[model samples]
Target: MSLVVTTNVAGMNSQRALSIADRQLTTSLERLSSGSRINRAADDASNLAISEGLRAQIGGFRVALRNTQDGISVLQTAEGALTETQGILHRMRDLSVQAANAGSLDDDARGNLQSEIGQLRNELDRIAGTTSFNGRKLLDGGYRTVFHVGADAGHTIAVDLGRGTSAAALGVDGIDVTGPGRYGPGAVTLSTAAAPGTAAVLTIAAAGGSAGFSGGTGGVSAYTDLDGTISVGGRSFDLASVRYDTAADTDGNGTRDAADLLAQLNRAAIVALGLTSPPFSSPTPGTLAFAVAEPLPGHTGTAGAPLSASAADLARSTPTFTAAGGASRALTAIDAAIERISTVRGDLGAVQNRLEHNIAKLGVALDNTAASDSRIRDTDMATEMTAFTRTQILSQAGTAMLAQAHAAPQGVLKLLV
Candidate 1:
């Protein structure tokens, strides 16, 4: 089996040694240049898969972090608007207090005070309409915008800072684009219809609540499921249910009657005005139906249509001022608006806090992802360099021995000679 002339073991050993050396050198070059052992999929399929996943997560976390910062900016802007709005409310409250000192004032004095109060209200509306950040209105309506973190995997949060949709429009919806100087009273007045008894439906679209004419045994109870309080005049209405448009027959009939509707409103106003004590008395069984009195023949023409007051105005006109006697029914509307602002602010605060927590958690996630990717693909330069040096020396020694193997055939040629 030992054929010295034909068979060459040194050549075979040399070739095998050279192949091993070339493999070591290629790995060293890869580690040094690319800084990764897993440049190709065949290197380590499982580890490559894991590293890619971690890298993707790291990229996503970076975007999420930026989004968190954006959320913070939005919150700060909203907070600023709320602070200003709070100041405006305080001023309005003080004016309402001053207006209530009827003993020290005549009709003219009270009217002048009302004009100033009206002006303050108008100013608030102006501020609310104009204040904005990043092209987004912060105080006016349509500020309750929803933010989605991602598709199904992420959560949805609100970014807009206006009072809830309900209070902003006073149960109205959608954006108010007219921008200041348009809103006359806090309440949108429905002008007299073109024709009488033509059925002109004036609607106040209830937002974030269920308010309807409940003709059932239960009297009228307009509910707000969201967490907050709304004061209409001096009466504080608490919303505990999220449902809106629940019918609590304000008209008193098993069926709805528009005239009775106003009467019910007047009653509620009286309660809000603090004319009636809390836990309002239930309507007597089979009570007289609501009747609309005839309009006054003529008023001593005043600038604001001051007509002769009537018996109905007597109950409804009672001041429902707060314990400090600073609150009024007119002021109650402002209080409702203020409460809504605070509730929205609270909601924004909650979202900001949650996002901040998420930002911290995402930071940790990004760090861990980077570490995992490094472990999977990064090479130890010192270890690779040492192996490369050993391979270089072995390859050179094998090349010299291969030359000696080539000369082994020459010995057989000399014997034959």
Candidate 2:
């Protein structure tokens, strides 16, 4: 090698090595301090991309876990309400059985049983109406939703609680369990002389029949004109719009008979005039009895005033246990209602089990995904420390060698001297 003053080649080589060593040392220190192998895109581009994708999946799994938990809670709430409803049904069933024994029970004893049943039915309805989860009704026959149960879109579980558990929904709303029971008091008889725009005379009577109205002397005439508007409660209906059953001309009187008129009045549209229950019950083929004892559902009006009932409420008014034959019919109805409730409860249980399984699956997925991300992006302390030591040693050695190379230029001066 030539000795020169202008440039010491040995020193330049040592400086270059030192620079490279310092850079490696810095990278090693950063990895050790941060505990990450890939702190930026420059560290490992492809691995960084893979790590980010795994992170997204992890986040999605966390949120989906929460959603699954919420779904389970909603189902639990609905199931709890159904449990209460089942208890109420069981009690009502016991009453029906007791009332069925007409030979052993008198009218008063059966009446007591019927009273309790009516109260139970009311409570059942209240539960169905009020049960909710997060302000969403769970038992009103409209609960349906999806829970995200996986880390990806379109991975979901659907939950649906069937129709409802109300007394009406269960087909036990009007169970009487008493033979020949009068429709509870506060019903008005419509007069044959009732004309449109004239307030129908409201008479309180204890009519007797298989279903509350007896063939009695006081009743409406079949030929009474019903082709105009009549007001009930605070609403009006065009009576001419009433759809009389074309097939119900029982009297063959060349015109619609009282039975046809009664059928029209009981039509869902007319009954929806705001009463809590159907307003009209027939005592005979020609007589229409109106019930004004209670305000319409959600209505707070005084008794005896005209009101309306929804079609749903009307369907709930089927008489039960009012006579020997009625009691037999009620047993069948109660059995069917019980079966329906059992089916709903079974569905809820199945959904709960599915949710629990989904949670387990999510946990496993989260663990495996996290491990994969760690492998791609996290530092291995043992391996990184070894690299750090090697770079540190090279840095020190390079510095000493650079000093020796700088001294080589002085030797060239000595030769010149």
What does candidate 1's lDDT look like per residue over 1-417, in tens digits? 454866688788887888888787887888878888788998899988888877877777788788777877888777776777667666766666666665676667666656665565565666767777789777766677665442135556666554423223632111111222111122111122225333222122223232322222244333223232333332354323223344345545654432343344445534533433222211222111111122222312222221222222222332222222333444666667677777877977888898888788878887887888887889878877888788888888878888887787787777778
- Decoy 2 TM-score against native: 0.68
Give the residue spans of candidate 2 off by over 4 A. 181-327
> Worst lDDT window (10 residues) for model 1?
172-181
lDDT of 2: 0.68
lDDT scores in order: 0.53, 0.68
lDDT of 2 by residue, 95-201 (tens): 88888888898889988998998899899989999999889998988888888888897998888887877887887875667745323222211222444445433
